[model samples]
Target: MSLTPLNEDLGVLRFITAGSVDDGKSTLIGRLLYDSKSVLTDQLSALSRAKHKRTAGEDIDFSLLTDGLEAEREQGITIDVAYRYFATARRKFIIADTPGHEQYTRNMVTGASTAHAAIILVDATRVTEVDGQTELLAQTKRHSAIVKLLGLQHVIVAINKMDLIDFSEARFNAIRAAYLELAQRLGLQDVRFVPVSALKGDNIVFASEKMPWYQDEPLLDVLESLPVAEQDGELRFPVQLVARQDGSQADDFRGYMGRVESGAIRVGQSLRVLPSNRSATVAEIVGPSGLLDQAFAGQCVTVRLAEDVDVSRGDTFVSTESALQPSRKLGADVCWFDEEPLSPQRKYLLKQATSTVYVRVGSVDTVLDVTTLSHGTDKTTLAMNDIGAVQLSLQKPLAADTYDSHPATGSFVLIDEATHHTVAAGMIRTLAA
Candidate 1:
């Protein structure tokens, strides 16, 4: 009847499983959830009653657990991002199951933006041996590149459906060697390869007896062992709301409510209000339980300023020692998502944190060919799912950070004024000096 609250004490690993179509992303997640006893009895019963048949030939379709959308189930492809949360004795996990289709590459970008790790699935059957060299699928390389572009340091290349390959160690080795080359080319720092059979639960939650030669930790163990990426950066708090308590002077309070995007906040700290350039001191840190002395990243709290120095939603409270500079023009890396192509003539809404401003596409510098990891010749318009380097001119100045600096402040989304749909996701690369 109710959802279980996220256990912060247990530590959460936010990761995504992404690959080409039919690579068993949803099934892998389903196996992790089902085998780990995270699924309930009624859900299991519902699986039994489902009409969709799986190749595994059991009464239940494991993909049913994650492929909740009718369109996804019908097409047998993931179109939108499916987020699932599960926990084990050692750690809790938030898994983003992303689409594998090239048309939905933006969905992969969206899912991986906040993830600490990425499990890029590769179908063992798709591995081709050409003159003693392994050739990888384009989708696999695209997903891996996008994962790195999004700044995910920890990557797991899961070669799924190993059972189909007869659990061949040679096949796994070839794929691993080829992937290591790709990882090196992409500058991926941490990558691990694992052989899994999501359909039959091989090397998923437990070791598969079928492949005793592959002596690495199971997928669950790798996930459980990975250290949750530490949130470290300058203090940046984008105010979402300014709460005001009315009725009595005795309880009169003005609290700025927002989540700590990065760094830490504490009582009696000097805070700087961005754009407006006003300064204030932190008088109190109010949390759900009571007043606290300090708060870290990811904790949403209400902060009472020592002085009312003109603040509201869309304003940011940052560390006075180091603050972000406000700018009107920004250079960014954009992942275009709309069906309609992006052009310089179009006017859209740019939303970063709590701030939304009118913006126009200044120029298309380079359109990246994800397959080859090179820039294409097109510099005019960005097509659907195209990654491009673009310049944006904003009507109002905003305090922005480079994507490499802090993801929370560096990331933004572009909204079409007419359709109100998010047209693109952008990561700031540079701010006009």
Candidate 2:
């Protein structure tokens, strides 16, 4: 397919780069930014003088662009999620350079949570060819599983370091076939494959002359062409705080402040306060600049209700006709982050958007085995980096949607009540009876 830049109306594309250790995830991002002229002069100068130059000769080590931490520089590996923002004439971009180590899977999850797409890099040199079959790295499977779980709109599996293997088409095809099998097992909807050498800049920003067999658009072109997933659904406005004025000149202004999570809210629109199920109307919409006739998803605004109907911080306002109802039981898929195994006996706090409630894991249904791409029902506990399905019993009813439908309201985090540390990132799969 020919390359086409996104129109200005398409908006920004938020994506993340992921793969196993030494798969060139950081290098790929660096190459994208460097070749696209997204890097500033000072940044380029710093790369030239970087103390840990992994590449030989005068070639710039592109990985240094995103590996900003001193530890990352010294170790030559990304430790935390490094985010970079740049714009092209065609589109604006936000790239999250996620760590590849299994130990840092939580960090990867944190980065992928808000991303619209993911680029998974597979090291061509690392793939083991066994009698006409290719074996992929375990981390590749894990990251792809997480992408499916997170419902990323698009996925690009870039076979990197192809230069090491003489840009062999046979090897590329073998790897692609293996990944396709895994993608099928994981039920990933949108996936594409590209052959690239991040270090050599082949098939990254431009098409690679070395690999003539690959006729598709380069990595950058594919990204620009990929549609930015729009947040579509009914109005979901979670009240973050209640804005009130007590002064005489303020005319008793009472506004519920929060970002519209999904859909749009307009003036005079009828809304229902969740949990309480009280009715109200949008009297006015206040934006950062001033009054706004309407507000859409991702915009932070204060909504003045036509009537005071017992709204407070953590309460949600939805379309009056919305089918969403308060429920105390929920079924969810979670990626455990803590070293401590999940204990159903213990109480944990579930924080979803503005609402926080005490919750208990009622049952550990199944745990995913990334190596086999299968779920094991015998597993009763989830260790760090393990993805599992669990049933939760909440102390109070919560208004939520399934993660696949509305991510902003459907996602949540589990916190250790004693340590106050986040333990697991969860996605609601079903609203239990």
Which number leads on TM-score?
A: 2
Best prediction by lDDT: 2
Tell me each candidate's TM-score. 0.92, 0.97
**Model 2 per-residue lDDT tens digits across residues 1-433:** 5446345556789999999999999999999998999889998888888889898877899999999899999998899999999877778899999999999999999999999999999999999977767899999999999999999999999999999999999999999999999998889888999999999999999999999999899998888878886998899998999987884674898888999999999999999999889999889999999999999999999999888689888899999989999989999999999999999889999999999999999999999998888899998889999999999999998998899999999999999999999999999999964
Candidate lDDT scores, in order, read: 0.88, 0.93
- Taking the candidates one at a time, how many backbone clashes does each contain? 0, 0
Residues 1-433, candidate 1, lDDT per residue (tens digit)?
A: 1122334354889999988999999999999999999999999988877766464444567888988888888888888899999888778899999999998998899899989999999999987888978988888888887887788869999999999999999899999999999999889999998899998899999998999898778888888878766869889899999899984687788999999999999999998998788989999999999999999989999999989689988888888998477889999988899998996888999999999999999999998876677887666999898888899999988988898888888999999999999999998999984
Clashes by residue pair, model 1: none
The parts of candidate 1 lying over 4 Å away from their true place are: 1-10, 56-59, 130-132, 246-252
Superposed by TM-score, candidate 2 places the C-alpha of residue 380 at a distance from the truth, in angstroms, of 1.6
